[model samples]
Target: MHPVLFEVIGLPISPYGLLIALGMLTGIWVAKRRGRAIGIPEEAVYDTVFWGVLLGFVGARIAFVLVNFGAFLRDPLPLVFSREGFVFLGGFLAALPVIAVVLRRWRVRYLAMADLLAPSLALAHAFGRMGCFFAGCCYGGVCDRPWAVRFPRIIDWRRGPVDLAEAEFTPGGAIYHGVDRVGDVVGSPAFYDQVKHGQLDWSDTASLAVHPVQLYDVAIQLGLFALLSWMWWRRRTLHGQIFLLYLWLYAASRIVLELFRGDLERGLWFGGWVSTSQLISGGLIVVALGLTLQRRRLFAPASEPAAAPRDPGDA
Candidate 1:
């Protein structure tokens, strides 16, 4: 609810931006420490993170714009420049190639580097989701439960719950009018009461009462971070195993959590229930498994050792 942290003289400082910065800094710090422990050059880790951040930001914005192109078309400038709308998967995808190229140029083992980064990424995601919670952007639908958070101010925007008038269109192609007060029955009368009173009306909070999917994500990611850290600490006896396992774990969690994401309006293609995120998660799971299997084959020990080559005319 506290979107803005403080005002310096007259300028407002955003809590969301601050939290995101903190998360990034913490993630980088953790990665650098882990990198050194794993024998990676500290400088290379920093450079990789620098490029990763830049590429990740760009990729996240691009993905968000693509997904919500219709909304972006209405106001392109704000949509592009605004701090909101970043997708975690988009950032991860964007950073992958950038990190790979950097590692390749530096002659660093990409798989080992990825393993070091896996836990840090999850840690960062946990903080970033907290930022989202503060910003009220990636919000859950609604809830009447005890843990449910009611953000009245968030619904004041044209895209929020209070603006449900925009969601309803008449058969004659006219936009429906919003009631300035209670007693309106087109939608939920209880919702109308809450809107009019500037309070959360739990009676109509069904779809809105969806589980706090972001917190669920945070909890899952923290567990993943712990698991990856343990695997890395134990050295796993194989390169890339930790990274692949992280991917598998995260994808599985996402697939399950996406079920509670009532905010997504898109429907499944074949069945009654499915999500875009779930589709992506399934793909990631398959890719991770393939990579894990490939790593085992490539890094396996050789059956015999070859003799050193002898130079001509040399002893």
Candidate 2:
């Protein structure tokens, strides 16, 4: 795992931030093409996606802070400005109403637009998950399997745990010191957990082997993108069909995936029986199912008026 992909003239370039930006651009490109195909103006696509992504970032940040309020309260500014901690479900939820408003103002069918954006969202999410892998965040529980990954420990003076091998560290902070755990040591959320619980130690070079949940998410998102694209092209029967199916399938996948997550900071509720993402996924599944059924009934091709009621006497 490598957080800082490289340095440009002494400025470290973060793979997490880079990949997210790439995902955004890829998503916009996809949305534009799909929009044009479906008669949506190019400008409208740009405006809608731009505003949605901007507000989505704000929402994701807010949600992450709220879930980890205790930590933020203890130390505020650094975490607030940190590049990590955005939650995807929070961003998606925030963008929903904003996109709806944009479409309604334009007098466009919101459901149709949602369908157009669904596959793009999935594809972009796949890229984001790839970023998560490179950053070594959102890791999975320990595993002895052949495919389990070992993240090198890399904690920056101000950034806490980083994924860089040559990250410069200065002497600071009471808990972490520059000279304490030196060299190219493996580290990540998984590493933090293992070290905290005595499963691993600072003296060890790499983290305990763990499941590659980030890659699992990447696979799931890519598969969902393909499935939604197929539905849009061939199997769609309603305006909201593709998007609703996307919500349902992605939510279900998240629910299953959450079980393997090792990052407890993401949020755990009901005595840690469920995660915040899992809870959101449950709600989305219900909403998707209800909307799908309602749309099917209300928007199904109007049937020919059931043959004139009897008409035997008239005949």
Query: Highest TM-score: which candidate?
Result: 2
Q: Compared with the true structure, what per-residue lDDT tens digits does model 2 show for residues 267-294?
A: 8999999999999999998888788678
Off by over 4 Å in 2: 155-187, 297-315
Pairs clashing within candidate 1: 141-208, 142-208, 142-209, 143-208, 143-209
Please, what is the whole-model Cα lDDT of each candidate in the order they appear? 0.64, 0.74
TM-score for each candidate, following the candidate numbering: 0.76, 0.84
**68-95 in candidate 1: lDDT tens per residue?**
5654665465458765668778888889
Using lDDT as the measure, which candidate wins? 2
> By summed lDDT, which 10 consecutive residues of candidate 1 come out lowest?
172-181
Query: What is the TM-score of candidate 1?
Result: 0.76
Superposed by TM-score, candidate 2 places the C-alpha of residue 188 at a distance from the truth, in angstroms, of: 2.6
